[model samples]
Target chain A: MIDPLSIFLLLLSASTPILFAALGELIVERAGVLNLGVEGMMITGALAGFAVAYVSGSPFLGFAAAATGGAAVSLLFAVLTQFLLANQVASGLALTLFGLGLAALFGKPFEGVKAPPMIPGPFRINWIVWLGLVMVPLIWWFLNRSRGGLILRGVGENHDAAHALGYNVRLVRIGAIAFGGAMAGIGGAFISIATVLQWTEGMTAGAGWIALAIVVFSNWTATGVLVGAWLFGGVTVLQLRLQAAGVKVPVQLLSMAPYLATIIVLVLISARQKFSRRAGGAAPGSLGQNFHALR
Target chain B: MIQLVPRSEVSTLWQFLTPVLAVLATMVAGGLLFWVMGYDPVAAIKTIFWDPLFGMASSYSRPQLLVKAAPLILIASGLAIGFRAGIWNIGAEGQYIIGAICGAAVALAAYPSEGMWIFPAMVVAGAAGGWAWGMIPATLRNWFGASEILVSLMLVYVAQRVAAWMAFGPMKNPEGFGFPGSRNLQQYPSASNPELIAGTGTHWGVVAAAVAVLATWFLMSRHIRGFHIRTAGLAPRAARFAGVKPETLVAFCLGLSGALAGMAGLFEVAGPAGQITDKIGVGYGFTAIIVAFLGRLHPVGILLAGLLLALTYIGGELAQLMLNLPAATVQVFQGMMLFFLLGFDLLTRFKIQRRVVA
Candidate 1:
C-alpha cells in the first residue's frame, strides 16, 4: 500500500536538511577548512529558528535568525582556529559541545511549543525545500565557474601559493566558514520549522555528523553531495516505511541503517581512492591545516 | 598592537601552565554566565568548584568523585595514546556500550551460576567486543585512507540504537514483568561489582583506573612503541623513514584504546550502573576526550583532570539542587573549559610581540 510518489516526496523533504548542510560543508572543505562543528551550528539554528518562528509568526524570520545564530557560533570557531591557531579538530569538537549545551539551555523555554506554519511553494512543498534544491546548481556553479570559487580552490590546494599570489587566505577561509555555518543553520531550521514543526533539545541528533560523512561520500563535489544526501534520505524514508509496515526487526536496529550505510559508502570510496593511488580522494590540499600569516 | 610570533622551540613550561590557566579562565567565564542567567554567580561557582571538595556536602560528594572519575580516567588513558599518534577515535562511547552489552550478556547467560570465573570471562568478552568495534575504523583507515573521525562517530549512533534494542528486546528483565532493562547486576551477587570500601566508592573500577594510569605512564615514558607514536604524530614522514608502518600504528592505537574503553564500560556495568539500560552510555566516552586533552594527553595529568571534571559533575548536580540552575549549565561549563583550553594553547607555541609600524 506504499505509494511511490509520496515516498519520493518524503525522501526529497527528508534529504533537504542534509543537502543544505552538506553543500555548506562542501564549500568549506573545498576552501581547505574542515569544520566539524556543523552539528553544533545546526542545533543552534534549530532552536533559534523554532523560537523565532514561534515568536515572530514568520518562518522566514526564523530561518534568518537561525542562519545568524549558526553564523555567530561558527565565528567562535573561526576565531579559535583562524586567529588563535587552535587545533581545528579540538576546536570544532568544542564548538559542538558548546553549541549543544547552549541550544539546550536556550531551548528550555521553547520545548513542546509548536513552530509556525510553513509557506508553501509551487509543488505544495515548503519554500526552503525548493531553496535547497536550487542551491545545488548554484553552489556547483559557484565552486566551478566563479572567479572567487577558483581563488578559494586555489587557497585550499595551496595556501602558500595563494598567499604568494596575493589572495587573502584567512579572510577567504573565514567567509567560507561563516557561509558553511549559515547553511548549516538553514538546514537545521528546515528540520524544526518544515519537517518536525517543533523544537526539541538534541533533536538534530546525528544529522550534522551524517552531513559530514555525506561530504566525504560525495568526494568533495557539489553534484555528489546531492546524490549522497538523496541516497541517505531514501534509506531513512524506507527504514521508517519498514518499521511502519510491522516489520519484525527491532526498531533500534532499523534506525542504524543510515549510519551503517554511511560507513559502508565511506569504506567503498576510500578503497577506490586507495587503489587509484590518489592523495585523499579529492580532499583539499590544506584541509584541516590552520593557516598562520607571517609578515 | 599585539602580534603573535611563533616560537622556534615548543615551550615546555607553557605546556604545563596552559591547562591551569584555562581552568581559571573558565571559572571567571562560567561565573559571568551564571550571573547573566540571574543566579548568584559566586554561590553557584562555589557549589560547583569549591563546595564539592570542602563544602557542607563534601562528605557525600567526596566518594562520588572516584565513582565518576573511574571510567573517565580509564577511557581517557586509552584515548590519550591514540590521540598522541593522531588517530582520532571519537567512537569510544559506542565501544563502551558494546563492551557493556557483551559483559552483561556473559553475566546474564550464566544466571544463577555461582562461579568465580564468570566475572573474568565477562571482562574478556567485553574487551573483545570493544576491540572488534574499534577494528572497523582502524582497518578502514589503514587499508583505504578513510577518515576515522567521521566513520567512528557514525558508529556511535548505531551503537546507541543497538543498546536501545538490547534493553527493549532480548536483555529485558524476565522475572520483573515487562520492564525494559535487564536484571539489576548490583543485586546479582555472582556478577555484581561491589564497592570494596563502603562510603569511599572504592570499587574494582577504581583499582583498574589506577592500574591503567600507571601502565600508561610506563608505556608512554619508557616504551619504544610510545616513542614511535610520538614521532608519527609530530613527523609522519620521519616516522615512516624510521620504519614505523602507519597501518600498524593505527591498528595498535585503535585496538588499545577500544580495549581500554571497553574495560571501562565493563567495570561500569558490573559495578555502579548495575544493569543494561537504554541510557547506560551517559557520555563518559565523549567527556573522556575533554579529559584526555585537558590532561595534555599525559597519563598522570589525565588522572588529575579526571578528578577535576568529576568534581564539576558532582558540583553541577549540587548546583542544580541548590541554586536551581539548569542541568545543562555543567555541560556549558565543560565546553567553555575546552574552548578556553584550546585558546590558551596558543600561548604555548607563540608569544605576542607589540607591532612596530613606521
Candidate 2:
C-alpha cells in the first residue's frame, strides 16, 4: 500500500543530510584539502541546531546556528593544518574526536529536548530538503562552469602552480573547509531538527561516515554524488520498509544492509578505477596533502 | 609576516618536550572549557589528573588504572606499528568485536566442560577472527586500489551490527530467561581472565600489553623488517628500491594489528565485561589512534600515554560520582589532548621564523 510518490519524497528527505555533506566535501576536496572531520562537524551541528531550535522555536534559526557552529569548529582544523603544518590526516581525525567530545559535553543538557516543528516548503517537503535538492545543480554549476571553481581545481591539482599564479592557496583551502563545515552542519541539523525532532547523544549514528563513502562513490562529480546519495537513501528506506512489513529477516541483520552496501560499492568503484585504463582518476592531485608556500 | 623553515635535522629535544607541553596545554584548554560550562575548573581538573593517584580512594582507583590501560596499550602498540608503516588500520574496534565474538564462541561451545584447553583455544580463535576481518580491507586495497582508511572504517559499522545480531539471536544465554547476552565468562572458572595478583589488576591482558610494548620496541629498534616499514612510510620509492614489497608490508601491518586488537577484545570479554553484548565496541579502537599519535608512534611512549588516558577514564568516572559532572568530560579531555599534541608537534619539525618584510 506504499505510494510511489510518497516513497520518492521519503527518499529525498532521507538523502538530504548526506547530500549536503557530500556536496560540501566535494568542494573541499576540489580545493586540495581532505577534512575527515565531517562526522564531527555534523554532530556539533546536530546539537547546536537542536538546542537553538528548542530555545528559539525557530527551525531556520536553528539551522543558521548549526552552520556557524560547524564552520567555527572547522576553523580549529584550518588553524592546525594550514598554519601549524600538522599532518592533514591526523589533524582531521583529531578534529573528529574533538568535535564529538565537545558536542557531547555541551549536548548533555539538550538530551530529551524536542525541536520546533519545521515549516514545509511548496510541496510539503521541508525547506531544508528543498535547499538540498537545489544545491546539487548549484554545486555542479560552481564546479564545472565557474571561474572560481577553475582556480580551485588548479589549486587542488597543483598548489605550487596556483601559488605561482598569485592565488592565495591557504585562503582558498580555508574557505573551502569553512564551506564544507557549514554544509555538513546543515546536514547534521536536518537530522535532529527536521527528521527526528529530538536531540539525543550520538544520534547522527555514522551518517557522517556514510556521507564520506558517498563522496568517494560519486567519483567527485556533483551528479554522481546525487546518484550515490539516492542509492544509499533507497537502501535505507527499503530496509526500514521491510522491517515494517514484517520481513522474515532479523532486524539487526537487516539494519546492516546500508553499511555492507557501502563497502561493496567502494570495492566496485575502486576496482573499476583499477581495471579501466580510460578512467582518468578525478581525485584532486593535491588531495589530502598540506600546502606550504616554500620559496 | 611569518614563515616556517624546515629544520635540517629534527629537533630531538623538542621531540621529548612537546608531549609534556601538549598535556599542559590541554589541561589549560580543558580547564577553560570546564569554566565555560560553569563548573569549578580547577577542582574538575584535579579530580581527573591529581585525585586518581593520591586522593582518598587512590587505593581503589590506582588498581583500576591497569585494568583500563591494558586494552588501550595492547591495541595502540599494534596500531603504532601499522601507523609507522603508514598503514592505517582504523578498524581495530571491528577487529576487537570479531575477536570477542570468536573467542566467546569457542568458550560457549565447550560449555559445562572442565578442560583447560578451551581457554587457549579461545585466544587462538580470537586472533584468527580478527586477522580474517582485517584481511578483508587488505585484500581490497591490494587488488582494487581502495583506500584502506575508508574500507576499514566502513567495516566497523558492519561489525557493530553483527555484534548486535549475535547478542539478540544465537549468543543469547538460555539460562538467563531470554536476556540478550551470552553466558557470563566470569562465573565460568575455566574461561575467565582473572587478576594474576590480588588487588593489583594484573590480568593476562596487562601482561600481554607489557609483552607487546617490549616486542614492538625490539622490532622497531632492531629488526630489518622494521626498517623496511619505516622506509615504506617515509619514502615508498626508496623502500621499493631496498627490496621492500609494499603489498607484504601492508598485509603484515594490518594483520598483526588486527590480531592484537582481537586479543584485547578477548581478554575484556572473559574478564572485565564478562559477556558479549551489543554495546561492546566502546570507542577504544578510535581512542587508540590518539594513543598511538600521542606516544609519537613509539612503544614506550604509547605505554605512558595509555596510562594517562586510562587515568582520565577513571578520573572522569570519579568526577561523575563526586562532582556530578557529565561522563563525557573524560572524552572531551582526551580530544583536547590530541588536538594540543598535534598542534605542538610543529615545533619539532620546523623552525618558526620572522619573515623580513622587504
Model 1, range B101-153, lDDT digits (tens) per residue? 99999999999788999988888988988888888899989888888998889
lDDT of 2 by residue, B1-358 (tens): 7889989988999988999999999889888888888889999999999998999999999989999999999999999999898899989999999999999999999998968898899989988988888888999888887888888888888889889999999999999898898999999988999999999988989999999999999999899989999889888899999899899998999999999999989999999999999998888888899899999999999999999999999999999999899988888888888888899999999999899877
| Window of ten residues with lowest summed lDDT in model 1 chain B | B143-152
What TM-score would every model get versus the actual structure?
0.99, 0.99
List pairs with backbone clashes in candidate 1: none
True contacts kept of each: 0.82, 0.72
Displacement of residue A41 (Cα, Å) in model 2 is 0.5
